[model samples]
Target: MKDAQKPDHVSLNTLIMRLREGQFVIPDFQREFEWKPWDIKELMRSIFLDYYIGSLLLWKGKQENFNALSCERIYGYPKGNGNPVHIVLDGQQRLTAMYYAFLAPDVNLPNRANRALYFVHVDKFMAEEYDDAFNYDWLTRRWSKIIDNPEVQYEQHIFPLAIMGAGGWELPNWVQGYEQFWKNRTQEAEEAGDADAIEMAAKSTENAHLFGEHLKGITEQYQVAYIELDQDLAVDKVCDIFTQINSKGIRLDAFDLINALLKPKGLQLKHMWRAAASRLEFVETEKMNVYILQVMSILRQSYCSPKYLYFLLPGQEKPVRDPDGTRRKEVLITDAQDFEGRWHNAVDALQAAIKLLQHPHEFAAISSKYLPYVSILPVFASIQAHIKTIQASQRLDAQRKARHWYWASVFTNRYSGSVESTSARDFMDMKAWLQDDNAEPPLITEFKTRFKTLEFRKETKRGTSVYNGLFNLLVLMGARDWMSGNVTLADDLDDHHIVPKKWGAEHLQGKVIDTILNRTPLSAETNRHVISDRLPNQYLPDLIAENGEAAVRSILESHCISPAALAILLRDPFTAEDFEEFIAERQRTFQEAIETLLVKERLDLPVQLRELDEQIEQIELGLRKVIVAVLQADSQYELPSHILRNVKERIQRAAKKNAALDGDYYDTLEGKMEFCDLRELHDAIKTKALWPQFQPRFVNKETLNIKFGQLAELRNAIRHSRSADEITRKEGEAAILWFAKVLK
Candidate 1:
């Protein structure tokens, strides 16, 4: 195609006039509206001093045509009647400022009138007659001339508006004063009716003409470049011109501008992501912007361009036009949608995976080398999706399976250095393995089988080998949350030596001190005050004081350390038998807990699926209820009768089907009431909706009863009154509790 023609060079007046008319529109994807008042002022000053600014670059593409500019895209453009003419993009900030100044009446322009006009002081001009005659008061907006005679006070002031008529020119302060001086002499003679009056009029007219001529000369000498683009010009060409001409002498990064070009179409998606990011910030206030951006970039598969990820979403990429001219350029609508959907799914999976990693005890032991890979959420989402497809109880299996795959993938990809690839082929292979039913080694099953082999078994002075193993597990689990912050090393923190570190020489049998089995996690602060060697009488009291009596009791019951064992410990202080027994029991419990947690996490699939389904149903039901309520209002209240009737019918049917039953069921085999009517319908609905698919597998009834009481209070508030204030408070409280449970 022939290159689009550039605009003929035009004068400032012509350019300003064209701008005043509505022939131009700024593309919505242009960079954020940014121009300080002083910046506008400086531009005006430069124009006033230099007479011309510079040229503008433009592009001419069809409105809907999708094409890549040289790596530097300016902004997104809407389809136009003819081919789109993009501002190749010089003078964007300048033209935008001018456009706003002329068109937007409410725009807060400095000085109120002619924001483009700047003042020069009378002191700038010095001439014998002009010096004494001219008086310029900028603050009061007046220009005046003083009569020569000291006794007579005759003020002759010139207003800027009067001096600059329709086709006007600016005059220097000196010329303005000289013109006023001649006019004053003319007026004096005219009043006195002397020969001088006629003489002064001629002098005054000549002087005024001379001043006008000088102003016109200055206006003619000033110039600026104006480049117009034809409808077919590419944006990259303009950006190159901009890079060459920009006074800063620095070139714009090509990728940055290309990213900008994609922005407009991505606004909706950006807003959605931002909203989610905002919620993350709400949960944790520090450096959330950075985290959100990092998360977004990884999910979008453009982490390398972290700053521009928001703009260059895959969904925003434009399609290239065919060189053969057989097909016109058009948006790849389906491709964009698919890309966005996949990205969103990845985000969802990552969010689910992080919930498991947030546990302080479990996550603290994870390693940092695999942090970044594990943190990538898209990988997690793909794994989750694959696992769900293969597992019969997918919804319940999704989170746990997702967690497993997350860690497994991290281990394979990051630690082994065998799985990481920009092509994602390796990750995809793993995903396929998990999804395949007939595969010889099912991905999850194989992962479990290898986990034992890969598991760290060597003990170190730092801590157990299990810590290293768990670190690797965290990466595979897609635990980005654990990636942040420093780990609480057992040495740095209070980790009790279950068999005291300071065992007597006789009891130790010359064994080295830093045994892994002897230590267990404890609060650092509590460890110091508790002391290493406790006297016989003080041991039980010291343990109780620090860990609480209940913890001590549990420890005593679980370990079953006999009186004889205690007596031996009192005598020798660090007997091998006690240490052996305690370490063995503690390690077993620890291993069992982790194993059970993993299994329970995976097994709880059905419950979570049901809960999610129930939640969706409840939301639909609530919306229906709202519609019914609106319809049931009296016709006099401005509701249409037919609509109301339809809504009422739907609600009535829903109510009859036990929509209001709140998912609570009571058994009554005989003629007896089996459940209390405590108005807990709303609580029941929320509980049913929120309850996790995987139970902890160890429920404390007392804790459950306490939670039930809190639920009862909330139910009472909902049932007793629907007042706006009461409803809002109850809703807020319920939301807080619900979120707390999720975090727990």
Candidate 2:
């Protein structure tokens, strides 16, 4: 096949003409417009100075592929197919900036005001005697107005670059007008017979003549270069080139490529994502499009990253060599056939997820406050809620399961770093659940319940902290707006410590009041007017007097304060200071409420290490099991009683030595024994004094020591309370099973 084997370097005028005629297009997979006003100015300065900005990489597609190319133009899209469409694979930013900077307001452009705007400095080429300097100097506005109307706005030089927008920036008439005006003035001066005035007019005319020259230089020239790639290259190869060109500079965002891929099919990804993200009230908009795009990938491609979607394109069997020496065949445009529909589904799922978070049956997120883990959105969006394989009745069941998983994910932070892999896994598991009624819910291997003081404080801040998932669960249990009669919590509400900070400061250190149990959501009105010194008992009567006791009781019930707990704070005398007791009681309820929700839905995981104690598989050390297996290979290597004596004596001697060497106090027997741990015992066993206790009874001492060292590592991890990801499921179970068999 004969491709147009060369690149062409045309004048900037020809490039703009091609763009105006729809020959140049921002391909569907290119990124959304990201240049700012400053970027436009810098680019314009570079162009005016004839600086080499960069070259454009345009994929000059074959007629069929070009015909398939319907894309967003740099400014206004061309009205008719004046030339074959060529995709801009690079130099889009510079081109876009220039196009918008000079797009004429009169060109019947669609939404001209909202698309892009630019302005040019007119002071550089204005008449020195002109009074227009004050009006245009150092101001920023779109250059889409009267650019050449030198006398329109001010006394001196100012030009709207927009005058050049109508494809031909014909030179200005002001200089000529001034020249004609000065010529007329000379005649009048000569007639008046004041020779000195004539001389002054002549000098002004000379200045006017100079401005005309500077004005022509800006309007007549355009300077940008580009390389147009022939259409014979494969789509994958094109993407590779696009990525390589951008890698060292501004890296190509995957969303940009997706935009290019989708535009040919009538999907304006930027507009679609903008609409979707605006609906997300409090979740910050930074990378919101990327997140939604990832969600779309998960639903459509069963992947969380768009880069991975490249391979899913319809590839050809045989590769043909391209002009760039890349051997590749064209992939059909059918690669994006169902993208529009699937993206809509993802949007629907995202809306459903937002709603689920804001208003849930139990453990409601209420708002962004409780959405600590942002990674759950993709997994939630990929639920395949209305898959055809799912029965009508089971759809609701599947949704319920999704909800359970959402809470479990929030509790465990399941969608952390491996968000893509986790989303794919969760979606597959969720899809299976929907299709096959007997499919079990996905497993949550580990979760953490111990909220460290500082982290908990950070997490519990009303709308600011991510720790609100737990707070939301507590609210679901019964925490309600004290004055709102249990209405759904509003974003405007506030939270205050149950034990006032000033009072608790004497009893505690570093924000003793800044805790989940101590903090409770208060109505905005109450928060604004409350007396900080007043105890809940004191505040209760006033609230009851204002809103009535029945309303107050409803608020307390909604806030998850049990009647008994409220009674202690409201006892008529109310003399006893029971903030500690009150806090303890509430904390217990909070913990119980969480457990209740987890058990209610069977979405439970052992969030606490103690919960995994009875089920030792969680903390089991696999290396310990290997050591036991090697020891038990003889089937008769029971530890001698004398070895136990040796171990006990070794522990006692170590404690005494530690006390003497480190000056550690050990008055009680229990205190001395506290230093004893499995690793410590193993260390004692490894000592030369105790090594011979079972040298013959067991296997190789060297082998056992190496395995025991691994066991020591596992013991250290457990002691430090690391996540269970530190150990694998097979390793955990193997350790427990092997140890049990050997111990028996």
Candidate 3:
């Protein structure tokens, strides 16, 4: 489109008067409400000082062929028609100030110009002047108090115009001279019956020079480039123009211009925002912009950015009905009722999301992008509006419901790829396919095929195995055997080595290898103890006792048979195949438990499950910190300074190590290794005391039954166990809760 033509410069008075006529409206997406009262006063002062403030920018546009112009009420509202004749593209601040100044009941008097503007009664400046004295009383010929007592030492307070007209006038002498001059001029006009003389006397008495000089200054200096756009110009185009021009020193936020266009449509973007803001009262508005962005993210699911809203409805004129009976497209604002209902729905959904967040375990899988999407609430609400129930099973069958849930996840996950890219499109298409009515069977078939092919066992060197292997194992062995096996590879089992590996000369002499058979599972407690002292003999007794003969024999046949017999297993080098089989079995067990645990924990639903992970991580981290603190404190007693320092350093290192893992090691060797840090061990000792309410029972140290000191020894034994006992669900929960309490 060709560039719109510019308009000629106009006077400040004309601009101000035009603005008062409702010549414009600030859009809802425009910048935040930021004009202070003082800024308004300053603009007025400049106008009153005759400073050229600038001209308003006007846009000529059509809404359904009706001629319309964009403008603003620089001075609140006009006395007559409310139609804004002048739309301000620039100089909004100055115009806004002028508009507000006239509406304001109280006028801030300038310090230097105080005596000069004294056309009213001298008493108006006297001690404790009433508000009535300062206002112009039009009925009275002169100011009310001044007319009542014209000769009450008026020259001392009033600034006579005759002296003002004369250059280099001394204030004291000119005051006396102007009083005499006004007296003569008044008498001459009355006696001669000359209208000119009467006008001069009145004008001179009112100190017109002060008002004139102020107006002159405003008209001469302040310059505004007022560009008037043709009706064809779109709101987005205008925004682009505004941004380009203002990009130099001062610039408008993209949303600000968007708001200006959105405001008059009665979209109530600001009101919606305010409502959201109210809900987040705990966070300040300035700090809540992210939250606001999040809301917008939800509102416009297709477009993550709020700025895109402007492009959606691009024009100066309001969207209205066509006169020729033609159909008109509707924007979000077109259906105010529907929009509001949807908005409220979004708000309600957001409230639920926040509640879910309180249990971080539920939101652990949620991405930052997803966070903003959920914050929007509208998208969720709309999908929910169509649903019979938001429950997981019901939603699975509801296509509309599923789509919303899927998109929420997609947007929330941020997809880790560009939305505009082919990859993203494919993903979306796949998601849609999954939700399609006719394609449901094919989708289910594809899922089954994928699930069957999924490797439950995959071996990786120096890292935790995937859950698939673990899940398969859990299913094959059955829950009872899995929970009570020799070596106790159960709830809190950590992946361990059947043969101890160390970073020493002995291992260096042999072939370095990565094998699964060398790996066995131990509980977190046993793993910690074994990590410090890498010897299989120390843990053998515990393993045999916990698992019994059959479990031990099974483990040996599956993992330790390659190198002659089970006794020679630890002495021989581990083969790659041995490692692969062990990892594969573990992965199978892990996969089975993933969904099982989710169900057991009542977090089987998608949303709830996502949240559960976050909560669990938070609880775990909190516990670790508390343990570290106690360990640090405990090190201070009896130990030599060097030994204490060494322990503290190790504890710090362990905490740091755990942090890097991002809380993924719940039942892993690495997790146990972290607990081995003395600081963590110390925290375990203090956990009972720190959380007395939860651990109310006092342990008798003498009897070695649940005492703080005795527990400390138990922690040591668990850490050192070569073959750890199986961890029960209750024990796992207690450990997690204890950590959370300590952190709190």
RMSD of every prediction: 30.5, 23.0, 27.7
**Model 2, poorest ten-residue lDDT window?**
129-138
**What tens-digit string does per-residue lDDT give for candidate 3 at 331-445?**
5433445545555655665555444432224332122211323332333333333343345554534543243333233322333333323222333343354455433322222
Off by over 4 Å in 3: 1-308, 311-327, 334-344, 351-414, 420-578, 588-744
**Could you give me the TM-score of model 2 versus the true structure?**
0.43
Model 1, stretches more than 4 Å misplaced?
1-349, 359-378, 381-393, 406-436, 439-519, 524-571, 575-744
lDDT of each: 0.40, 0.55, 0.41
User: TM-scores of the models, in the given order?
Assistant: 0.31, 0.43, 0.29
lDDT for each residue of candidate 1 in 1-744, tens digit (9 for 90 to 100): 753444334454544445443334444334544765556445544543332344555554444423443222221112332222343355677765544432332223444433322222222221124323322222222212221221122122222321222232323443555566667777777788888676956555564654455344334534444445565544565455555656566433322232333344453444545655633321233323333333344444423232223233443333233667342333322344654565455455545544434443433333222132433433443444455556575443234444555444433333333222331543444544445522212334434434444322234344223444443333223222111123344344333454555653446654333444444343454345454565333565655576675655544432333334344434444445655554455445434433433422321223333243234334334423432333244332222334334434533443343433222232111101112122222222224322231124214434544444554444333332222355444554564355345333
What is the C-alpha local distance difference test score of candidate 3? 0.41
Top model number, lDDT: 2
Cα deviation in Å at residue 224, candidate 2?
Answer: 26
Instruction: Order the candidate numbers by lDDT, best to worst.
Output: 2, 3, 1
